[model samples]
Target: MSQHSSVAGASRPVKEAGFFTKIKNVACLKSSSSSDKGKGGKGKSKSLSNKVSHGFHLVEGQSGHKMEDYHVAEYRKRKNHTLGLFAIFDGHLGDRVPTYLKDNLFNNILEEPNFWKDPEAAIRSAYSSTDKFILDNSMQLGPGGSTAVTAIVIDGKDLWVANIGDSRAVVCERGSANQITVDHEPHAERRRIEKQGGFVTTLPGDVPRVNGQLAVARAFGDQSLKAHLSSEPDVRHVPIDSTIDFVILASDGLWKVSC
Candidate 1:
């Protein structure tokens, strides 16, 4: 079945969450529920056991520029296992890259030959291949790019997370938050960019940027800055247990604003 979501020209809000000491609840795109799109581009779903669910809300940004963000939240059956897929693709310059990712990234990753035996290696391979495809077809996809954070839950038993740029995933376990992805900001990876013959610039009042153009040092597409950018993602694996509550996959406003 198709995903329950993908934001169009709108960087929608995720689940409505209010944090007061006693953590109430949060939402995710339901893994087993049918599409539940409502007014204003919203959708909700629940897992087969009804133990976990997801929801989304869309809202346009006030930056004047059309929103380029896109997302994925759905479930798929593969090899007798139920896989819950979630992701956030924060784009800049245009929406082409993120839109393409929302539609194709997971497919490519799942199609990797070694995905079942060596998930990490398969994920890396797919990430590299996907980025190559995007860069190779820059003319058709445009010169824009996107930062991404993706999570795959295997029957609520294992969780796999991977990311590039600054899109992030935060997991709540026993009511404590833990970040499992790393941000590839220009400032953090300066030496690497310089080694690629690109320089990072930090003006007095601005954040560090790759060659003074893109704010992130790694992402998909960005053919114009491909030489200085990396598309490799930092992937992690976490075994799920009773203590784990939920995971939030998104690029917070801090990352969103810079892009």
Candidate 2:
């Protein structure tokens, strides 16, 4: 029951995190608008250094439930540098987990010990620890889980992305688009899931699902299926230059149709 907010048309320093220490007391940042079920919005922002203008749009899906996807599109000042933070969190079963992520995931990543020296390691560790936190508090977070794709642009010089589940990041350069994150579908990692004592099923008319429940093989929360699920994200880093024009970060709803 949290309302969504956006940092569109302007930039702000990453705010002090609104941490969640108590379950029922959690609240998301207040916003004039909300992306409730069947409702969507669009926004655009520009970086201070490179002037990399980034834009995003969310479209309500056909699903007849409250919006489960959460997102962040903002520019932040950190350590005398401007960082562009973009992400999509696709939730299933409930919204608590994604809402938790929309609030804390980036804060957790930037706070990682070696973020400057090794972003990949820092991101990996953060993802693992974040997922652990979600799983450990599943009773309060609910039985739901979410797939996430986060992109961080540092001082307009580098772009680092990490993802779990089917949410993806696509980088555009010289008029061509290239996907930079892997889609963690159930069939691709069946062996690992099987070894963990879980089974994926593909009915005649349905897509493969983990334990006949979730569609993604890796995600945060889903405490009931944690034994077979992986929260380890595929992390990628790239140096940005003149050729790197833009990047798109979106939840699976934007791409699942083609598959």
Candidate 3:
């Protein structure tokens, strides 16, 4: 099994060469209130009611390149309190964008001055700002793009999830699953794309792609397609009370097969 690293408080960029290439890895984080089960999960108890214990798993796709999916788990100790974070990034073309996100997305989000007072707005601003950074620093990121789904847990009870592109976050309550983020596929968002003067096309044997390039309507990077694509994420708040169980965050590789 590959070992996951901690980027909790480091102020630096993640080296691309250190990107994970394993199919399964395990890491125990000293954080609070969040758990996730990806597709193909086994041995997980169904009755986790109100308790959060997380485990993540990933496998490379048949696509002829390094796995483009990346996940984040970190704990930060502040002067007054501690923060727990979890996230998933699914990249297309190259893993640089996802790698960058794994290292910095939440740090950017939490650094927002209004995060404690207005988390939703803070998340939105952070996402857009992060996307801009990716674009401005494209020389290091390359021409690829990525999707993101992130979760923030406060006091192990209040939960917030944010996403761009098709990667997803789902909550399980008493064995029933409920999606917490929206998938931004080109097909479902055709109208929005057309409104922006962009087109979605389904070429022979391929799903719809924005300008026939990206399958997702929203993403970070893809500098050439930025005007047609969006980086704004859909953010939602869910209270981890008695009725809720755990959450699932996965890339399209798992979601497409599971569904």
Candidate 4:
């Protein structure tokens, strides 16, 4: 996997207004205050279940550029033990890499022998293995690449996050947002890339990118840059407390538009 330019060329003009308008419409429709009074004055209410103590919600926004290749998944093994995993694979040139990651990464992690005992090690193994799997199967996948950021929430008490790209995970607690996963941007994550002899630059007609090709510094599928881009994820064991609220996991599209 090698990074390629996603910057729209001269043919694709940026549609700022249309992009934001669609986002606004989707946001409004999902809002609790939105009224559904067409067929009747009553709106469908979310069922409350006392047995269901914890739940998960996921929403994927469209890509402002080509297709939204990002993928997300949330699963629970048992009623009390919940596992929430979300990934943003910013694909460049094609969607094969992201789609491949979405289908295989979590399963690889869960299948690891050490997963039940040591989640951090399991995550590391899973990341490396998945990357290798992609490279081995690259002939079947075309010449595209992707950045990966994944988070796993276990039992609503522990969070293990891994990343190799600019996709972000933010924890909104006590009315404030705290970034959980570090954005693997060349500019911000310069130290790591520099240690590996990698650099960042902007092409003559392209957006700022890592190594003049990738916009992100770390990633799993960039086989060409494996010597520089990392696959080891930053793992943290966080205990969910009273002050914690819902977290937001989004791709570069949302972060680029918002930040």
Better by lDDT, candidate 3 or 2: 2
lDDT string for model 4 (20-128, tens) is: 3333233223223111111111111111221112122223334344553445544447444656565556676677877788778888988888886898899989888
TM per prediction: 0.84, 0.84, 0.79, 0.71
lDDT of each: 0.72, 0.74, 0.69, 0.57
lDDT of candidate 2 over 63-167, digit per residue (tens): 566677777777789889888887888888888999999899999999998988898999999999999999888888999998889989898788999999988
Better of 2 and 3 by TM-score: 2
lDDT of 1 by residue, 27-113 (tens): 322232222222224456755545556554444555566666677777788998888877778788787888889889999999999
* Total backbone collisions, model 1: 3
lDDT, residue 192, candidate 2: 100
lDDT of 1 at 107: 99
> How does candidate 1 score on lDDT?
0.72
The TM-score between candidate 3 and the true structure equals 0.79
Residue 108, candidate 4: alpha-carbon lDDT? 92
Clashes of each: 3, 0, 0, 4
- Candidate 2 pairs with clashing backbones: none
Error of 2 at 100 (Å): 0.2
